[model samples]
Target: MNERLRFVDPTALMHLSRGLTFNPLRSAEVLDDVLAAFDEKNGYVSDVQAWVRGGGLQNGPCPTLPSGRIVADVTETMNAERKVLHAAAILKLEREAGIAPGVFLSMVSPTLDVGMRVELPMRALLKGNLPLEGTYTVYLHVLMTSDGRDLVYYGITKRGWSLRFQEHTRSAISRESHRLFARTLRDLTAARARELHGVLDERPKLRGLITTICATGLCHGEALDVEEAMVEKYSLASKHANGLNMIPGGAAGLRAAQRFKGTH
Candidate 1:
């Protein structure tokens, strides 16, 4: 009865309407009412009412309703209803929260991994949400010796893992000092340098040696925390023979060399 009309995605509304076909005569009216309810409540509804109206429950006792439907049938019906509601919810969120549809879809999907989730804020930024800037993960890239016995380098980037890797390769091949990883590899012993050179020279080889260890969907401070933790845990320093990290992690990495003298 609340007359507040909330915006709903047309596609999502269509999906919800299609899902109500079991009771065709009242489907249109039910869909209208459902939309109205969502609108009035800022796009949310009571779970029990949603289930009942979504065909997971029906009238009558005994063999007419509860006794007539098997567990699998009820579960299937409930799942179908849930999908419709989820789609509607996502659409509502998109409209009200200004969330990009792709980002909402990724959040609703069941299989999104940590890396993908961590990338959502960046996606939002690309979609013109400037407020999310500097809050996404600064992913860590670990490159290890061919035998995987030791880590060869530790890298962190807010740009992207693949882009940073390409930069490392380019800087190494061009003998440029822009990328510390490439510079470190270039400074290693001949045999070790050649091994890493071959790896960086080939895209597939470079990718194979790289692994993303920690990805977080937190602010820059959290990302720095993760980077520092990884650096300490992995001992990514020149003192570690196999480590290729030129300096310590986080802001400390940017300090002048004088500060770390005789500190080990």
Candidate 2:
């Protein structure tokens, strides 16, 4: 649960109630009618024009005057001029008021809806598990051997770093030769290299030799651009160094290389 949960201000509610000149006897009914309308729209934008038109929310003919209808009308007016509100607050209000989660979420905006989905895993991660749902810097998993040289066995994923780390470890341990990283390990083994020899003998221990570099966030087109940049920067195009990249970064890198080749 978010500790920062906020509710609709009483002052705002009171002002709205007054604008509708709601009947004291049927205040609940009026509130219900107005809320139902909002629920129908999954909550409108703060500046929604449709809400200002004063349509919908009529329950039926009543002998005790149309106080509920008036309240609905007032709500529409207030909603049109009201500032934007977070969907979480509205959801919290509905929950506290004994409304079902299904109904509350059903009317939430698409953005808020995605946020709600993202929130669950994020909260769980904050409690000491691997994190989720945030912009992450893609990185390179480079192995530094006993010698001064390094070998990049895997490119980091744009998704969760920890999750990707686990995936690499799992794939390497399982000796999935089809995977690029695993294929690199096989190649290194076959070469009988002394410097980083037996590096992949115990795949789990490889994590210690591997260092994750270039952690970044939310800029330069996020991880994809960064990953491509790193790949190009460290590429052993004509060098004697060993790199595990099967593909040459992204499409942009390929295009740039092609242009260079054409000019030369």
Candidate 3:
């Protein structure tokens, strides 16, 4: 089994934008093992197996299947494209969770028409596994027009979309404050940013004018209106340039608005 494991070369640990690379035979073997476990222990359905059977090639286009359902018809060709589909699923779950909408979330102005279209499907493609942890990170690019409509490009991370914010647990505000009080607040804030983006995309009046602010170093101590959980998350983002900064402080409206305009 260990030999087979060695034969099952995992995907390379590298930045995603460079390109997609994989070991087909090894990947095939790993897929087989995963499918076997899903069936034997996870109680995954036959249809799900069918999706992974092809190594995910055949499963993605079937729009009829629900998002959370495991799939089997995995094809190397399909693996790359399925992120968007899965991301939409996670977005649906987020909406269902009924988390409070961030105060800063709002729509773009109708007269502006200044932004581009951000599709839900493409955003899903960015979802994949993370380097530090085996969790997923869903990446999304949102477009806000001056006219108060939004375009969002969303997807799972390249490694695996399941890697992000997987550890989030609901607790009393006091308890939540204590858990993240001393910890880095970047992840918590980024999660809030994503959540706000998800909601702003739907609300036409707000038009996708949502903003996220991330500050680190000396700035972390400064007071802000953002939730405590988000403060932690944003702090981390600033540290890595992986954080969100839509707030007026870190990056002013002219800069961020330009980025939205693609002029930056």
How high is the CA lDDT of each candidate model?
Answer: 0.37, 0.36, 0.29
Candidate 1 runs further than 4 Å off: 1-134, 178-180, 184-207, 256-264
User: How many Å off is the CA of 216 in candidate 3?
Assistant: 29
In model 1, which range of ten residues has the least summed lDDT? 67-76
What RMSD does model 1 have?
17.3
Q: What's the candidate order when arranged by decreasing TM-score?
A: 1, 2, 3
The digit string of per-residue lDDT tens for model 3 on 1-264 reads 324531111332222211223333333354445544544653433433243344342345422223342322322322454431111111223332322111111122223322212121211111121232333333333334334433322222324321222222223122463333112232333333454556443222222322221211112222222223342344233442433332332224235557768953
Instruction: For model 2, name the residue pairs that clash.
Output: 42-107
- Tens digit of per-residue lDDT, candidate 1, span 1-264: 113222222232222122221232222234334444543653332332233334321342111122121110000112544543222121323232332112111122122111111111111211112232234444444443334443455555554454566666667767876445686444432234444445443211221233332442346666667666666566566567556676776656646345766465
Which ten-residue region of model 3 has the weakest summed lDDT? 118-127
Provide the global lDDT of candidate 2 against the true structure. Answer: 0.36
Per-candidate TM vs. native?
0.38, 0.35, 0.21
User: What does candidate 2's lDDT look like per residue over 129-208, in tens digits?
Assistant: 22223444454555443344556743544454445655665675577747565655444433323224433442322212
TM-score for predicted model 2 compared with the true structure: 0.35
Candidate 2 or 1, higher TM-score: 1
TM value for model 3: 0.21
lDDT, model 3? 0.29
Model 2 lDDT, residue 190, Cα = 32
Q: Which stretches of candidate 2 lie over 4 Å from their true place?
A: 1-132, 146-148, 153-156, 185-208, 236-240, 251-264
